[model samples]
Target: MSTRLRCLLAASAVALTAACGVGDQAGSNTVTMTVWTSNQAQLDLLNRLADDFSAQHDGADVRIQSVPQADYTTKISVRLAGGDAPDLGWLGAPDAVGMAASGQLADVGPALRNDPEYRFDDFVPAAFTNWRGGDAVYGVPFSTSPFFVIYNKDAFATANLPEPAELAARGDWTWDRLAGLARDLQPSLPRGHFVFQSNEGSVYGPLPVSWPTLDPLLRAHGAGFYDPQTKRCTLDSPAAAEAVGTFHRMAFDDRTAVPPGAQADFYAGNAAMTITQLSRLSQLEGAEFDYGIAPLPGGPGGQPHVTGQAGLVVFEQAPHKELATELLKYLTSEKAVRELAEFYPPARTSVLADAPEIYRDSRLSEQAVKDILVPGITEGHAFQYPRTWPEIKTTAQPVFDQLWSPGADVGSVLGRLCGEVGPLLKQAE
Candidate 1:
């Protein structure tokens, strides 16, 4: 066994032993969970919820282990493969599908159905779409955030460019327009400043991680990762080529977007605009420059909203399945959901209806939440995630690498990508 596997197994042994003792009636029990974020505010909120859950149940406690976002999915996979899985954890959209396919996740449908007060129906269908597999629901979505364009208002003014929100209001905001504006703003920017930052500054952290950045562009051009009905790769399609080609020009030809291995922070006022989710609003607190949030620009296909989701799930191998299920229920309960809305946008219709009030604590204005955040969640399609994503991502990375080069043929690179990953996608079906 690999050293990583051995370490995971050792960690699992300890966690599993603690979990086994959780069900004993006479003794105190602890349920352990793994989560990707170590943000103090988020951690404090989760810890508070865990404390409340513990208080409500006799002799029960909750322990949460923090994992870095980049390494989260790999660590979870290792733990599961090593038979040392945490009872519960957060799963990104792609990881949820992969885990569900491997039978490593427990179906929480029965537990959800049993809790009448939980009002499972209150959750928007799109929130849980990625977590569904056949007759079972592998997870409950906790974060159903949608990608939006955050622009530096001061930068736009200084560049003599129309604000994105104003353009959006006039129904003139389109991907072509955004690209042109980015190019126009490039020369006006400070020497090292950029016009745009692809999602998370394009460090190529992981192929799956790029979906938030790439999916909106693809969907805008009427393309997607694959066709849902046929389960075939669509990256080679004409629309996909056009969409990617536009971005390539922005990165290489126009020099507006931050290129591969280059860095420019939108929050730090280094870029004119960026595409990201609402949760990142916290990063803008006490900002040095004025920023404004707007919905993604429309493309040739018209306006297409793409949402990114993360779900809370129970592992099939969890020793305390019942306890873990209970915790999931409590965490997603209406009151808890409302509290969590401070960070993660809630999918509950009631919460969405009260968005103005619920979002008051956020950095975004009520209008921004209602106009951008709420609509994005309700109308957006979840990012596409195939069960064979890990393998497909590995196969496509080098091909993606080629796209970043100057004057690269995006169509040909994308075609080669489809040729390589198509079989894997088909197998997933």
Candidate 2:
């Protein structure tokens, strides 16, 4: 076994031995549970839930220890191996497959199946599936966020460009169309005032856009990054080439995208559109200009897709398993989900149906779900598996960075990158 895998197993062994059942054998009224999480905003929300849980359960106390985003995975792995793992800690959904293979988590399906209040079927299938290894469910999804396209309505009207909704319905709003619009508007606006981010490292504008939009386009074009049946990597296919080509042209060749070095362009009203998450809408309050949210446009494949991150998982060996599961159940309820939907999009279909006011003002969230996230789930989803995703982070970034440079050959650069990285992805298997 690999060093990392060995470490994970050792940690799981300790966790499994340290705790026996859900509660203390003496049946103590008070049960203490430990939690680990990354996002401060989410931690706050969970804190509120903890308060509510403690109140309802009479003598239960929940203690939370937050880990910084950068250190979460490493810390959890070490803790699990060393037999010092916290009960009910957060686990990354991307690592679900690999972790489940390590046999660290308790099978939660049987417990949840017997509880009517939990309503396990209400969650988005993708989120639920990602938390389960097979018949067993190791974790319950607390939150899910999908990427969407946000645009300036006034700018679109000024340029006489069609609203994204109309264009999407007409099947006329392709990536090329959006790029062309940016190119057309570029001449009228100041250089720094155009599309704020066309290319950047995985961040605010360009990087987020590529994950949710461009990556999906590859899937629509019939590219398979990994062959599930064969358990192999195939990221160098023609579809991948085409998808990267489009992004290269849009960010560099057409000069439609603003460089990240010019951050002032977006806040200064020079840029027109951006790719962002719905949770980020809070930052746009009291903007000087009128902006609108819309779903990202689709490709020739006739589908839009998005990349997302899943939140909150309970540890299998948690001492207070019953209470933790109860708290988790409450966390996913309509009331709790609606509260979270105020900041982040809820992963439950019921919450989406019940909470109209949350997304009422932000048409972006509504449209993006209908256009991007749902389609991605229904058609096929794509994501970098946790074990080998580091390869993509290291290799694909330089290629993307070069695309923003003047006179760079995006195709040759990407072709070389895929060739080099494909082997690495295969090695992880």
Query: What digit string (tens of lDDT, one per residue) describes model 2 on residues 1-429?
Result: 100000112233344334432223313333333344356686677677677777778746565555554556775677667655445655655655566657666567776777877677777676665666558787766556665566677777777777666777777777767767777776666545665353123432433235654565555556645664454555556766676666666666666665435454343356777766665666576677777665555666655555465555556656666766676666667678778776666767777665445666664555555656444434334364534555555666665566556676646666666676676666666
**Model 2 lDDT, full chain set:** 0.59
TM-score of 1: 0.92
Worst 10 residues of 1 by lDDT: 1-10
Pairs that collide in candidate 2 are 11-80, 11-81, 193-270, 193-271, 194-270, 194-271
Summarize candidate 1's per-residue lDDT along 295-350 as a digit string, tens digits: 89888888987888888999998868789889999998888999888888888888
What's the C-alpha lDDT at position 143 in model 2? 52
Error of 1 at 356 (Å): 0.8
Give every collision pair in model 1: none
CA lDDT of each prediction against the hidden true structure: 0.82, 0.59
- Models 1 onward score TM values of 0.92, 0.76
Output the TM-score of candidate 2: 0.76
